[model samples]
Target chain A: MRVALFASCLVDLFRPNAGFATVSLLENAGCIVDVPPEQTCCGQPAYNNGDKDNARDIAKQVINEFSDYEYIIVPSSSCAGMMIKHYPQLFEDNAEWYKKATDFSAHCYDLVTFLHDILKITSVPVTYQGNITYHDSCSSLRETRVKDKTRHLLACNEKINLLELGNPEACCGFGGTFCVKYPEISESMVNDKIADIEATGADTVVSGDMGCLLNIAGRLKRLNKPIKVFHIAEVLAGMTGIAAIGDADDTKKSEPSS
Target chain B: MKSKSHAFKQQAADALVNVSLQKALLNAKDGFIVKRKKAMDELPEFERLRTKAIEIKEHTLSHLDQYLEYFEQQVIKSGGTVHWASTTTQAQQIIVELCKQANARTVTKGKSMVGEEAAINDALEAAGFEAIETDLGEYIIQLANEPPSHIIAPAIHKSKQEIADLFKDHHKKYNFNSKLETIPEIVNEAREVLREKFINADVGITGANFLVAETGSTLIVTNEGNGDLTATLPKTHIVISSIEKVVPTLEDTSVLLRLLARSATGQEITSYTTFFNGPKRNSDIDGPENFHVVLLDNGRSNMLQNENHEMLKCIHCGACLNHCPVYSAIGGHAYGWVYPGPMGSVLTPIMQGLDEAKDLPFASTFCGRCEEVCPLSIPLPKLLRQHRNHIHHDKLNTSRSRLGLALWAFVASRPALYRPLSNSFIRALGWLGKKSGRFSWLPFASAWTQSKDLPAPAAQSFMSAWTQQQAKKKSSENE
Candidate 1:
């Protein structure tokens, strides 16, 4: 199968390893992956902020680039959500673009859901130690209904201990531009999320969206918590050799050997 | 009721640090959420009922004018006066004139979000009439000179201790000096003080949960029997409600009542579900002598013509507020208006001007939980986004962010510059933060790094790596 990896703008800049891990996971599942060079963004930030003109332009660009692939897999849920759920909304008035947007949305998928449901990959060939808790990103959980897919995949990995955190469905408040617009509210929400994560005593926090991972990991780092954060793709590909998000390499190398 | 939505950032910041308000909010949050969940769990047909409720509201709203006309005819047939107010000030003026004609010295009120929206108490007081709140929550906030925070639980932001203090401070005028430390004591004090007001008030005003056209009755759902007393014990009973509250039939009202209590306070039904049809008949012994219904449009008609017509489907259950994460985090006071939470965030900007309450639409994270929990299934996030669209298209947002979005959009739409530009920026960010793996501070991003570290970008952008991979693959294929 020819799969075009929609490495979202965040993954393109902040965390390319997630994109690479996604590719590794897809290839291991016996699927050919294509990273389309012309891809930019899914136009979520603009679409959400009500900039329909730019959002539609960005959508046209994305639709032009990825329409050739059999599947367009996004690494983050929010970006995938924007493509699958909102692109059609962007072109609700125009007939020609509306059909194109709807047709393209059906071919889009979040990375984890694509691997678990579409590819029928039950387990990853990689493993890591210590307790891991998952933060359900709001877009994936509500928009895409990506609840059991992550847990189902994680449950199959014998080497990883999956612990569920309290209120896992609660948002971590990394709402694209929301975090910056209302930092205090975002801070309060992430603090509550960190407390929930701390209560579980999970040594590592795993999430599907880099925006959420960055928000949670940043808070954890700020509070000086020992918990590490990683994308599910990174852990699934056993790419734990690199330092966890928001942590120095020395913190990983000179660990307390738990 | 004056809009302070623009100061939402400051108000939310204060609400987060308010220990007392946070404690009060935390204590009440679980009761509403958990009980609603349990009630829905017990009833197998909750989701189906929600669908029916949505249908009822939509059908009623689509034919709202016809139903409202029918409702007015029924009210006049039942010997009740129907007054139409196109604006909130008109509603207030009509009510004040009615009170003046009745020679009302003291007015008793049941908890009414509509009354709050009209600023009725202030208007009545300024007109030289004593307006007393009969509902316990309304009474507490009235004594404190505050607006109702939550629609159902008016004083949900007040702690028990705060209530005790408020009662001690305000109930002294009634010559009731008892230690009110517990919830029951505080409630008892309020009831004791309000009992006389209910009996002696010449005018009683209440808000309608649903206005039934078939029976020409206004339905109010309350835990306490304050609404019944406020309506029955006065010589003149005035019901102030928005035009959207009208329903086609009593059966439709019943369908809504089933979901209203369950959604608002998690009850199978409220303690009192009374329907006041009209003034007392000749044979009636103890009831109000005159009945008046003031239907306030107050921007609702404008909503009907806009993209936000669906918001008129709200039943004012407060379910959205309880289930909303943003509402739970900041509580209702931060919204700084008569209505707060998800519903308020959508309605305030529309009711008030888009420019007046500009920040309200942006206050949410668009979690969609409000829509999920709404009994009417009102697409709240969609309405909020509509407001955001208005704000954006009208250029109501800051020019800096507008320029930033413009620049970002320009770069994103062009891959040639975007690829190389983002690649170099990411490499620079990575190099700068290689030691800490995060940036404690960065230019133009202080708002982000103020409370949380900004994660550094990866050393290699995906596009560059993909380009290198393609080059290597082509070379290998050539060989």
Candidate 2:
């Protein structure tokens, strides 16, 4: 299978390892992967901010960039969901573009969903021995229906222990501009999320979306927590040798679990 | 009834630090969410029923004018009068005039949200008619001289101890001087005071949960039976309902009622689901001698002309409010209006004009949980986004944020520029935060860094790393 990696702007700029792990995992699953550097964003910020004109321009740019790929897999469900669900909405007024948008959306899939549903690769040959909890991003869970597929992939890794987080579907308060716009409410919500994460006593937290991972990791770091945060792709590809998210250096051992 | 939606941010800040309010909110949250979930679980056909409810509401809204006319005709045939009001003030004036005509000195109310919308109690009081709240929650807030915070549970923000005090302070006027300690005692004390008011009041008023076009019957669902008493006890009963509340038939009302109580308080049904048509018949044992239905338009007719016509399908279930993360954090007072929560966030802006209530839409996380649990499937997040779009298109937001978004949009749309600029920016940030792996503070990120550290970006962009990997792979394959 020929696959194009849609490294969301967040993953491209902030967490490239997750993007690389995505490529590695896809290649190992017998797929040819390409990183289209022309791709910039999924236009969610503009679209969500109610800037339809700019959202349309950005959507057209993204659509044109990955239009030729047989499969467009995004590591971040937030970005993938935007492409799959909202791109068509942006072009409803323009029938010509709507056709192209729908056709393109059909080819788009979140990374884990692509691996499990389309590629039929549920389990990856990866190893991790510590207890980890999964935070289900709202877009991925509700929009893309990615709840059980991710757990199915993680469940295959016998070396890893998966702890259930409370109300995993709850928002992490990183609602694009929401965290910045209403800082107090966002702070309170994320604080509640941190308490739930702590209750599980999981050493690591994993999720499919970079936006949520960054938000949770940011809070965990500010609280000076020892918990490790990794994108699901990183663990699935056995790429935890580098520093976990929100950490400056790989000062700790490469494999803390074993 | 005056809008405090403009000061939402400040009110929300205060609510955040309020210890008593937080404790009360937590208790309400546990009770509402658990019961709702269990009730929904017990009904295997709940989703199917929700679909039917949505369809019924949609059909009714599409033909609202026809239904309203038919409903009016049926009410007239049943010897009741239907009065139309284009705005809230008009509705209030209509009710006050009717009260004056009936020579009413005191009017008892049954937890009417529309009454709150129209500021009827204040108007009636200003007009020299004592307006008494009959429902326990409404009565508590009325005595405290406050608006109903939550729609169904008006005093949800108050603690039990606070209610006990409120009763002890206010009930003394009714010769009830005993200090109420328990929940039952407080309820009984209020009931005793309200029973006399209900019996003596010349007029009674209530909000309709649904208006049956087929039978011209106004239906109200309540847990404490206050609405039923308010609808039938006095010499005259007036229903303040919006034009969209009219349904085609009683059967349609039943389908919606099945979801209403379960969604509102998680009961299979409320303690009272009463339907009364017009005034008392000759053979009737008990009912008001006079029946009146005030169909208030108040921008709903205008709302139907726009993309927001679907908003009229709401049954005022309050499920969206209970499930909303924003409402749960700040409580209803922060929304600063009669309506609060996800439903309030959409309705307040439309009803009060976007300029006055623009902040309400932006306060949510757009989590879509409200839509999931909504019985009518109101598409609350979509309506909220529409409000945001209106605000943005009209330039209602601050110029600073507007300019920032414009600049960001320009950069983001151009990949060639955005790639290099953002890539270099993050690389620089990564180097600066090398020690902490996160930044405690960053320019333009005070909102996030105020309470949380921002995760530092990687040293290289994914595009650059992928390029290097490709070159390395080509060389290895050639070798």
Candidate 3:
């Protein structure tokens, strides 16, 4: 199966390891993974900011670029949600584009859902040792319905112990531009999320979306907490040996296993 | 009500550091969510009921004119009067005139968001009628001289101590001055004070939860039975309600009732679900001598004809508000309007003008929990986005933010331009913060850096690395 990876803009710029892990996971599942160079963003920023024209243009670009692939997978549920749920609505008035958007959306899936539901991959060969908690990105939990698929995949690794956050479903408040627009409210929400993370006493917190990971990791760093944050793809791909998000480059250096 | 929504940012900031308000919010948030979940879990047909309720509301809203007319005709047949008000001022004038006609010196009110929207208490007070709130929560906030932070639970933002203080400060004149220590004590004191007002009041007013057109009856659901007293005790009963509250029949109302209490307070039903038809006929036993329904339009007609027609379907159960993270963080007062939370964010801008409530729509993280938990299946996030689109079109958003979005959209839409631009930007940041892997402060991102550190970019963009890796693989396969 030829799958085009929509390495969401956050994963593209902030943390490529997640993108690499997604590629590795997909490749290991016996799929031919194609990184579509034309993909820049899933247009969530523009869409969420209410810039419909730009969002529509960006959506068209994404639909045109990845339409040929058998499947289009995004590591972040937010971006996948943009494609699977929102893209059709973006082109609702234009029948031609609407048909194209819906058809394209049909084949699009978030990485975990793609792995768990479509590929029927019960487990990966990678293993990690840690008491970790999972944060449910709002888009993952509500948009793409990625509640148990992630946990099911994580349970495959006997070495990993998953402790649940008190309220895993609450948003971490990255909200694309909302953090910048309403920093005070965003700070309060993320603080609540961090308190929940801390209550579990998990040394590591993992999530599927990089936007949320970055937000949670950034706050944890600012507070100078010892908790580490990693994208679910990195943990599942056994790439946790690299420095965790928001950590110093040399902090978690480990011998390369490959 | 005069809008303080334009100052939403400042109000939200104030709400954040308000120790008492924060305590109140923390205590209130989880209970509603948990109770509603439990109630939903207990009912196997809740989802089916929600869908039926949506259909009923949608049908009624589509034919709102007919149902409202039918309701008015039925009320007139039952010897009652109906008044139409296009705006809040008009609604206030109509109510005040009714009070004057009834020779009302004192007025009692049941909990009504529509009443709040019209500022009816303020209007009544200005007109020399001593307006008293009968609902326990409303009475608490009335004494404190504040607008309700939550629709159903008017004093949800007030801690018990705050309520005790408000009562102590105001209740001394009623000969009940001891600081109320327990919940029952507070309720009993409020009931004692309000009992006198409810009996002495010449006119009683309540807001309708739903207007049954088939019977021309206005319905109110309350736990305290304040609505019943506010409707039946006084000689004249006035119902201030929005036009969208009308449903085709009592059967339709029943479908919505099932969802309402469960969604609002997670009860199978409110303690009192009273329906008031019209004035007391000679055959009637105990009821108001005169009945009047004031149908307030207040921008709802415009809403019915526009993109916001779906909002009129809201039963005001406040399930969206309960589930909203932003509402949980800042509380309703910060939204600076009568209605608050996801529903308020959408309604405030439309009713008060986008310029006044511009920030309300943008306040959400679009977590989608509001829409997820909404009983009527109101797509609250989508409605908020529509408001955002209107703001963006009207250039209501700050020019700096607008420019930022425009710049981002420009580069993000074109991959060829975006790839190198992002590559260089990330590489520069990566090199600058190579040692720390994060930035404690950045020049333009003060909003984010103020509260949290910004994580550094990866050394190479994913596309850049992927291209190189693909080329290496191609060369290796060929060799």
lDDT of 2 by residue, B1-479 (tens): 88989999899989999999888887887578889999999999998998898889888888889999999999999999999999999998999999999899989999889889999998999999999999998899998888877888899999889998888888787788887788899888888988899889899999999999999989999889988888788999999998999999888888999999999999999998888899999999999999999999999999898988888988888998888888888889899998999989989998998989989999988788899889888888889998888899999999988998899999998878897898788779877887778999998899899989999876777777777778988999999
lDDT of 1 by residue, B1-479 (tens): 67887788889999999999988888986789899988888879988888888899889888999999999999999899999999999998999999999999999999889999999998999999999998888898888988888999998888888889888887788898888888887777787888889889999999999999988999898889999999999999999999999989988888899999898888999988899989999998888999999999999998888788998999999999998888888998888888999999988887778888888888888878888889988989888888888889999999988998999999999998899888888888888887888888999799999999987776778778767777988999999
TM-score on alpha carbons, each prediction: 0.97, 0.98, 0.98
Instruction: Give interface RMSD, every candidate, in order.
Output: 1.8, 1.4, 1.3
Ten residues in sequence with the least summed lDDT for candidate 1 chain B: B457-466
What lDDT score belongs to each candidate, Candidate 1 first?
Answer: 0.88, 0.88, 0.91
List TM-score (chain A only) for every prediction.
0.95, 0.96, 0.96
Q: What is the TM-score of candidate 3?
A: 0.98
Q: Which stretches of candidate 1 lie over 4 Å from their true place?
A: A251-258
What's each prediction's clash count? 0, 2, 0
Query: What is the C-alpha lDDT profile of model 3 across B201-292, one tens digit per residue?
Result: 89999999999999999999999999899899999999999999999998999999999999999999999899998999898888999999
Best by DockQ: 3
The segments of candidate 2 whose C-alpha lies over 4 angstroms from its true place after superposition are: A252-258, B475-479
Report each candidate's C-alpha RMSD, comma-separated, in the order given. 2.4, 1.9, 1.5
lDDT of 3 by residue, A86-123 (tens): 99999989999999999999999999999999988877
